[model samples]
Target chain A: MDLLGINPVLLIASLMVSATPILLAAIGETVVEKSGVLNLGVEGMMIVGAVVGFITAVNTENPAIGFVTAAIAGALLSTIFATLVLYLKSNQVATGLGLTLVGLGISALLGKPYEGIKSPTLQSLDIPILSDIPIFGRMLFSHDAMVYVSILIVGLVWYTLKYTRVGLVLRAVGENHDAAHALGYKVIRIRFLAIMFGGACSGLGGAYISLVRVPQWTEGMTAGAGWIALAIVVFASWKPWRTLIGAYLFGGITVLQLNLQAAGVAIPVEYLSMSPFLITIAVLVIISARGNQGAPASLGRPFHASN
Target chain B: MIHFEKRLNPSRITTVVTPIIAVILTMIAGGIMFAALGKPPLEAIRIIFWDPLFDPNFASYSRPQLLVKAGPLILIAIGLSIGFKAGIWNIGAEGQYILGAVFGAAVALAAYPADSVLLFPAMVVAGAFGGWLWAMIPAILRTKFNTNEILVSLMLVYVAESILASVAQGLLKNPEGYGFPGSRNLQQYPSAFNAEVIANSGMHWGVISAFIAVIFAYVMMTRHIRGFEVRLMGEAPKAARFSGVSTTRLVVFCLGISGALAGLAGMFEVSGPSGQITIDFNSGYGFTAIIVAFLGRLHPIGILLAGLLMALTYIGGELAQLMLGLPGASIQLFQGMLLLFLLATDIFTNYRIRIGGSN
Candidate 1:
């Protein structure tokens, strides 16, 4: 069925694809924050992932290998942030900004050669039985492998955080690093691993954009998706399940705007283009106004054993 | 194995020495990067750090360009340093700068045919107001709703960009220029042009304002009670609150001042150096100012020096881009490396390394 000269089914399908990158990034950041470390370099990590992924996919002619390399690159970059903030005690915010600068610059440098070249895009995976099951099948089951992986990752995160001993330890560290340290838990090591995982997820998200969404390399292609993912983490109240909802909502807005522009809607294109960021601000205000921000106690605080 | 011991007092010497060490380290690392890119490392390094000032072929042209570039950076960085000292992060100075330009340019555009001598000053006020208005969104939201200003301010940057794009294409489009998307070039308008006070000296109103801001910031920081309160708010928020410092007021004031300054910088740029408002008018000066603020150790005089040094790298980087086949992004990478090294080396200021010591 069509609404305002737009196909609802196609819009739903496209939004699922569009939301995967943000969903992956937000889920990853949620875990990092849960471990009492805040890495504000999500944009940096994602853009680097996008370029490295694009380069690898183009060279190897395998989108899978491209994604793998992007994750590795993202993790490697986050190691710089982890070492600086965790070991050397650099300011997390400044170091994160530096990481972004480095990521954007380095990505542009690396992606320069690959700018116009198109990589092998990800193919959609259709589950046999689900694919044949009418309208719901087309809406849900038909998507690239990464979309399914993103949702699966969200479910896994939810289950792990709610029921696993690992989750309990991570929560303990985030709530009180001193207590966790006193209790013989390795705060730094746990936090380091969490940060790397976050980086990897962010990398995958970026690769999704380069490989599946845009299907080509471009400088600064991630273009504030990383930042939006950050806001989504807050909008989701740091919950994994809510992150899925938040991503979908934002993805829907993005798709709707594009569709509206294509359909020649009466509203000014500038106003429509700016709606997502404006909505983000409004959402932040609303979420924060309700009083229970639910942020980790030691979220941005530095951890030192002697202290 | 080495371990760190907390110092009773942060070392005064290391505070000054670390930044220098960071710069040297950045050059070495940046040289290595250039070599990896298949260029001569030494030449690239020399071109970036040395050639702009001492290279006879480019010095005359690049030397004056230094003040033109450093002026806005210093102005924005000085304002940012204050809020940073209060532990308030206003990373959206980029948005504020853009709004300032849009607002300032609007005044010039509105009074297109007028030749009043007061037009430029009126535009300056409007520019500052625009930045202040943009900044106030985050400030008010943070104070009233307890929202994170960093995210809000940054998101508004995108919003401001949309506005800038809209105005450039719609409301502010130069009517006489056929179908171009940018606003009227303000440099041609005598009443609104921010011209150099001295010929070939690059001593425009913006550069003079930057100097005034530096002096004003230094005096306020060293002598004013508000300065002490700002420092206290950053160092120890609890104590500052207990001592009757209003958190809300400080947040509003700091954000307001920084926004206004950023706006002023934007105004100067659009009217003088930039000459017109276009889609890509802002070239990341607001974001770069954050690094300048930190590199200066959040000190006014230090920012003055750091702003000039940062500007040197910009000019030098451009020279390298012209002289060598290096990508434009290499300069960004170099600056990023500088900030990273600075952060890594800053550890020495507050802690001492103990070799093979047992806790």
Candidate 2:
């Protein structure tokens, strides 16, 4: 029998699971920013996803449908945001914050009945040879489909951003929307699609939490994960590979603090819990100090297309 | 052929009518949502907006609460509107609010055994300073490193929450009480309490401060050179620089003001309604203030009216939770929808849409 001891490995695994939501949310936010629209409502969207996903899973007895429904709900919510920012030319920051407020309210109303009930757990999938491998296996490969898909998403997004014509067009639009508009491209359409895609990704990330991570609906369940993800997007400098690095770095610190808490270190649990935010501030400082992190030139500016 | 056109002015009637139209539309949409939830849409709408202010049983308690809840929101939003107008986003007001509570509570706790009038004022000043100091971190970082203030300030809220939880649980824990995770009740100490200045009327120092903030904000926006610069900066950054406005100084000023106001609100909550520095004392006022700032169209008078309305919803929401079994957070969402709808309809301010599409 295994002796009564602090399992660093298991603790780390749980941390990864916790960090997954942030990673997924931040990655989506990074993409949204890259396309030159700063949508700060990721937290709102994720929480919406959490409630929608939880309700769907509960009703259907299927987690995959829950994930899909969550993504759709998130995108639908984001569409409201898109209509305002894209068509109305409202301040992105203000409208995004408003979207968050709306999301939080809607979710709380939706989730009141679902509270305290455990969601059906998301099954972990094991890769054949990778599952047998040491600590690296569980940490890297042998996990839920969402984890691997997030990695694949990062790679795909990076490649598409760097290589494809669509990537060039997107980057070009972000670099100068006015210029892109003159070149006969629809600036509003591109930004709209990007915003929706970001919302979808954020929704799935929220699903991972409600359906798998905590496996329960809690008030403010995403608990500023959306905000952390928003910061991580800035930390990554609108780059996909950098997003991966930024996410895991955040993930690592987040997990380490929890492990320290469970390991019963001398440090207070409050300090450990607060470590992720502090680390984010520290990392952002370092990134800015080092130099420009390649933030898109047109980010957060409302593009009014009349000459 | 190219047509270059500018529509500069709109009738005063449209300006007032647009927000009402947006509100009506939001209600219709919200009704659909309620229906989807299997609730009577009209009843839900009536309960959300109307009954709180008019209903006999709830109105007595909720009427007084309106001023109390609105007080801090108005103070915080007025502070934030200035910064937002100056093109400096201070999203960390939540952190500032928490820090304010912590600092004020710390002062109250340190002077716990001392029953002196100086205790409350000292704590209020300390709380304002606490928020100012927290906000300054981002201002300095942004000025020095050219860092993103949005991320810096927003992230600090979590740090502030952690600190709040830590202090509430350990350092400030009431000794006489059996290990509860909060400080001594300021309300119990008459010298430190922030009770109504006028008995039975819901008038407190916080409400008084909110009125003062509105007057100050109005004067600043209308008659002051600094206010002109703030509006100019948001509309045209290049023009602001050309007009010899100091971006760095303005950043510090705007952020400092917002943080201080937010802190004061937190201090008031700790002293008055909340009465103690508990982990759950903050009810997302910082985030909600962003809503008030926008809903009020970033104007002081607008915020004053908007703050009152938001306060009503908060009181109404609590009532709904008790009576209709509606969740508390739906109020926040309803308030958010006010901004969303306002922003969406604000397009009419500049552009007229044709039936098929904009022409």
Candidate 3:
């Protein structure tokens, strides 16, 4: 029931909750990279989603509306990046960094009034028969709608990327945009859509933090979850299913660290708190060292039709 | 419909003008934002851009603050521009900055009650080493394991922050004061204090170092073979490789120098303006320096001016925060706008717009 003064059941439940945001963000970014576009503004998009979602939920008293608006806001923000990088041919890295700065600054300004104000949170959806089952049900089947949605999204991404015609085109574009363009595929248009999708997913992840996770408005509440999601994409080698695993692993670590701190573990609190980032670095090194980094060949490369 | 045609040679005028245009655009957009927030747009603009330099009431105080603020930004940005020139991104200058401060402060703290003339200089070296050590993590990883330096460096930022928080509360805590989560104030120590070389003029050792860096960078970039290799690598990797440029060495050198400069900036800051190692000592200077680098067009002299301009915004933003009831974040929003516009307008530098072109 308990491991090291921590409840495994509760830990699993909370890990599912904590991992949802990162899973959503990483899955979206995988698609974006697959289209030969790299958006490093995940943190910015996530925070924007957090603030906008929290504000909407507080004002409308509807968590669903909050999430929808958050997605819209994120998509809208990503359009700026899409235009700059895809159309104007701005440096992808610098533009992405700019998006983050804009997102952080704008989110802070918007969330200023909503600070400390609690918003409507989602209720756990208990499937009747599953709820009646024993410990396994509690561990797996008792999460909110978004949790199910996140897993469902991952499944959809995996299937789409593996088997679909659209996925094939996206892969072609990512592998070599000029060749894709030569084949008469619309590279810029596809990348634009991919970026927007990425923004929306990042937004949803951010809203998950502000709504279900913390259930309140806080400036920079997402912290480095967005960045971690980015790391997960790499650790997953751009695979959706692996992203889920990476997210869960990260979520578990986060929860375990918090629990350890609460239980007054002998290790210094700061060291415990820093474990997730350190682990991220370790995983990144391990994945890269294996020689099959599996990154999209055209990842982070700016595309121009003439070029 | 309009389309862009790549210029055979990028327009020199547009290269200089685009940043100015970007600034003007940001002001207009920021004004609209301020108006939306129920503040007077024109007055807010004046407070942010104009008042910091010429508003008689605040100028004398703010003018000196400019160099104090610009010093670190220029130092860090100058270092970053070098790596950026080589197409090497070191966005983790923020982490490097933190480690530098921690390392530099550690030397002073460990040598507490000793008034040796060498204390300050020793701290400076320690600060640079700390930053270099931290930067080496990503550099070594990139060279050996082929990991993305951007992610690794950024992740280390959180690690460094954790270290900062730990030391502030544990090892570096001020023993004479009540148990507070910060190191001893280095400003109070005569030997460690980074005093203003000229009173009220803000010409401190850090500002002097920034000037020196600018001059050094200018010379190296224009005259040195290493600088040519860096530029060549960014422009054409194949060509640089053909010329026998070692990618590993370039990566290491760029990351190393940038990290050292970022660390030096942090050292100057903790010993001077910040005065101690605290949880919130770094106020996003590392990140802001990125914008400064771009705005300066990665040119040393340009970065100096850009750093000063950025420092002006910081002072003016503070003035606006006090004079007008604008939120502190609005300034961040303004700076972000500046960078976005700069990027957006940069197309003019490299392309000629063709109206009614059928391609």
- Candidate 3 residue pairs that clash: none
TM-score for each candidate, following the candidate numbering: 0.99, 0.94, 0.99
Query: A1-307, model 1: which lDDT tens digit per residue?
Result: 2246888888899999989999999999999998988788999999999999999999999999999999999999999999999999999888988999999999999999888888999899888999778887898898889999999999999998889999989989998999999999999999999999999999999999999999988898998999999999999998999999999999999999989888888888999999999998899899999973778899989987883
Q: After superposition, how far is residue B277 of candidate 2 from its true place, in Å?
A: 0.8
TM-score of chain B of each: 0.98, 0.94, 0.99
lDDT of 2 at A210: 95
DockQ for candidate 1: 0.79
Higher-scoring candidate on DockQ, 1 or 3: 1
DockQ, all models = 0.79, 0.69, 0.77
- Backbone steric clashes in candidate 3, count: 0
Residue-level lDDT tens digits of model 3 in B57-82: 98999999999999999999999999
* Number of the candidate with higher lDDT, 1 or 3: 3
Q: Total clashing residue pairs per candidate?
A: 0, 0, 0
| Per-residue lDDT of candidate 3, residues A215-276 (tens digit) | 88877788899899999999999988999999999999999989888888889999999999
lDDT of 1 at B141: 98
